[model samples]
Target: MKAPEGADLCFPLLLNNSCRKPVPPQSDGMLVLLSFISLLTAALNLLVIISISHFRQLHSPTNLLILSLALSDLLVGLLLMPVEILSTETCWFLGDLMCALYYVVDFIITSSSVGNMVLISIDRYLAICDPLRYNTTVTLDKTKICVCLCWMYSVLYNSLILMDFLRHPDSHNSCYGECVVVLNHITGSVDFVFTFISPITVIIVLYLRIFMVAVSQAQIMRSHIAAVTQQSSVRVTAKKSEMKAARTLGVVVVVFLICFCPYYSPSLMGEVIEDSSSSSTFVVWLLYFNSCLNPVIYAFFYPWFRKSIKLIVTLKILQPGSCDAKIL
Candidate 1:
């Protein structure tokens, strides 16, 4: 997906331009590989979410937030990825109405994924920073309200993109039946601010506060443990739990930054410079890479997630009186 000449942005292609054209028929192999990976990762995450949800023991606030994020990614895998694949093969072919619908769905799901991240970060912040107040602050009612607001915010943010598309006249295409929007710079700038910049800013600030709280709590816990003789083991266990939470949160924040920075950078550039470049294509693919990275992150960086997967896959470990069996 080289930059369409004169367009503000371009879709990311998996392979470099040198490999894009070849005497052999393997030109599109990289795109297919990426699509396959994205689809598989999305499916696995959905399955994990469903398995956890089906079991009553897994019905905690943290798990609920994970479920919400998985659902958002699942929507992207199902609705957006196929269109992206089609667009890679040929110019969009579903005509004006479907194209508009595609754009809306993409924006909504992508925005929702970011929104879920923000909410999850806040949840973790409260849980770690003020453990006593965590339960009261993140009650079922509050969680539901937060989730609803995330969806509502996504809808409102994407509505502008939809409006921009609708306002522009449809293109009488040369090959594909899809209608492409003449990217309006003003609306594009607004989209960048609302969809990318604001949400990212909020996430960074919340995480910073959460980190400070975690550090303070750890210091207090250490002091209490040093003063106690009998409760040392209990304090040690609590400390370990806190460490795990910190590690998981750290991974989430780092991955979010690395995956999203490239995708959003082009949008920022698009606002200032209307010229389309190959960098835009690169950013699009980088964003697509994000959809698949979460499952790997969970399975590798988070011990609890890895244990849950083990329980699901290996029934041999699920003994008659085991905690694993009880979780199932």
Candidate 2:
């Protein structure tokens, strides 16, 4: 039997006020593809979280920052990505209040993700350029504090942004099925400053300094390799490992910038951007897709992540001594 048109109504009891179900992904396979991406993102970031949390050897300060980044990306996958993938959600049935709350959470996660990147850049800068003080300055306890503060500030900042929306959820909704909050030029540009400009400035500056110091160290290493003694060779090897990590994280920062730029471009153009527009929607998902790529980058660059994945899939992490297995 063919279903009646009324059956698609979100609130059948209030047909006049209710929204019909939105169109699904353009192709039948598109939903499958997006759902798979969401699942993969969640699973990969979960592996990163579990790997660092469970392994004794992997509990370094840098890994702690990576763990923080993974947690934020995991939330993006689990909480945000599915929502974005659902037919662009033009016919939002979740109601006005939910829509307001959803964007608040979205902004918080995004802000924290940017904060994590800045923290990672700082960690790498210290590791590469000032190895002697890195350990004392970037302690695990201090990193934990910084991560906590990052999330707390994100919550506070975004909550303020959505304050009016929370109070009057439907104030900006244009139709029965619609759910969106538009930011004016002033708010949008200010948000761009806090969310993009400041953090990106810090990341770029620190990474540039790191790159300079790395090149200088490389030249000196090449010139003095023949004269270096055994004790100094051990130091050189350690520095090389840190430099490699810096380079890998540099890739992550570059990818972050690429994915993030398009999403914030409209604000740069001094125009108000709706969250519901086709172009904005595409860029939103593009950044969401970056969460899925983070762990893939880790798997490619980090041997421990690969080994940990093997152990996790092979069920070895469940064994009694797995925490001390020294995969690194």
Candidate 3:
């Protein structure tokens, strides 16, 4: 049954000016599911954070990028997910300034997460396709700098993209208790190119090349292993390691695209999208759900993550020399 006539107004006192609460067609089960996902997203990414941060062996260039990505995902669960859940059935009582700030935070974290994924693809590409220079070229210090630059670029780029909204916060709002942001044709196109097209292009191309190289390496390793030569064995072992890393990271990239592509489908159609629309809401939550899935993927694929989680859960990580424990 529909809610009673005036029951949906966010501000019953100013019924005419207030936007009605958005009661999405959500079942109680779905609401509970979303809540569980938000909590699980936070918990899973938090484990990744603690696993990578506290473990000395995980302090590598690639893990640093993963850490950066996890941090952004954690923000999604902690900050964005709850807001999204509340938004589904309620009107935005937080003023325009807060709305603008929320978008700013959302854009920065989301963009930075995308940037980090690109960096990870590049890292895997080098490890597989150019193993000779991968170590020197993609060092811990360099990865740290790149991670910093990615976040900085996200902040600056999104701020510029939303400059008008920041200046005139409620320029698009038709009533109180509604949070919505719409990008114009020009700004939307520009954002699509930078945040979606270019990064996706780079990731796809690099992964394709990495896939070919990994396949070739795998075939060579299998064909030559019977020789049992020391040099050949060493080469095979290295290639095998590289291929394994590529496969694991490939799963991550594929999942990222699956979760994110739907969210950007409107922009792909060259349309101005409203964030508050039902389709947009569903896809946005799908995007947030990716954050929860990442650590689960890691647990299934990475032995280190599984071990770390066990130690963390069993309180073994609290030991004085826990950081020195061999995890890999």
Candidate 4:
């Protein structure tokens, strides 16, 4: 059970002064899976980015939220996920400055992703519960401004959380190979309420209201189909479309909560949850794995996403005038 004398030292040259390198069982196998998931997340979110950006018809306000979500997930897959995977198997070879910067980038992307989800729930809530006003209220320009503000808010908020570490990156490190920045209980509590509690509460409540309205409308549509006028039929079709979009996005949100809840469990337990801890590695990866699963959820539920993937895979998107091609 003992690591042979110096086998546990991250820097054997430093002998007693070096931090012990953790030798987790089956770490090689885990690394391989993590690598694959990181690559998959990047590739899948890339498809989403290209699909929404290239298709003119897909440029709705709702799709803009999705585009924003995809951008955050793409950053996770491309940058944060890979770095976390490496950190799990080895010491932080990248300097303390990079370590502090890495966490800042991770927090900003994650908070923005959560913000996009909250925005999406609000979008669906309006579309389903107030269909008549949805278009006017959720205009493209307004949605664009909201998306910018979401990222801006995330950057500002997380910067405050990491301000001490940014100013003194090596303050918490006991040795050269370790990277850690601990927050006080007050900061931790503040982060939990804002990042985990408030946004999640809003998302769940809005979705609940949307769900009730959608069900009631669906029953009404079914019962009155034979006597429905042309105008009534058009309204019914729009309602169905809105309900479908809500349902699809609901799946994405549910999966997000499932993956995220575990990651925050330590916070809920009043424990100091450091990202560099071996105990938190599984939950952290589970959280990052959500990025890979988001695109899969879209492929299963949205026919347009499936079709877009086909066009992209076949290189049909390369032809002139492809942007005008009807995807929906």
Clashes of 2: 0
Clashing residue pairs in candidate 4 are none
Q: Which ten residues in a row have the lowest lDDT in candidate 3?
A: 1-10
* Top TM-score model: 3
Candidate 1 local lDDT, residue 272? 41
TM-score of each: 0.75, 0.86, 0.88, 0.88
Clashing residue pairs for model 2? none
Encode model 4's per-residue lDDT on 67-160: one tens digit a residue: 8988999999999888877777787777888989988998899889889888987897899899999989999999999999999999999999
Candidate number with the higher TM-score (2 or 4): 4
Error of 2 at 70 (Å): 0.4
Off by over 4 Å in 1: 1-28, 167-179, 225-250, 270-280, 298-304, 307-325
Scored against the true structure, residue 113 in model 4 reaches a CA lDDT of 82
User: Scored by CA lDDT, what does every candidate get?
Assistant: 0.63, 0.79, 0.82, 0.81
Best by lDDT: 3
Global CA lDDT computed for model 3: 0.82
Clashing pairs in 3: none
RMSD of each: 6.9, 4.7, 3.8, 3.9
Better of 1 and 3 by lDDT: 3
Question: Candidate 3: where are CA atoms >4 Å away?
Answer: 1-7, 24-26, 222-250, 277-279, 298-300
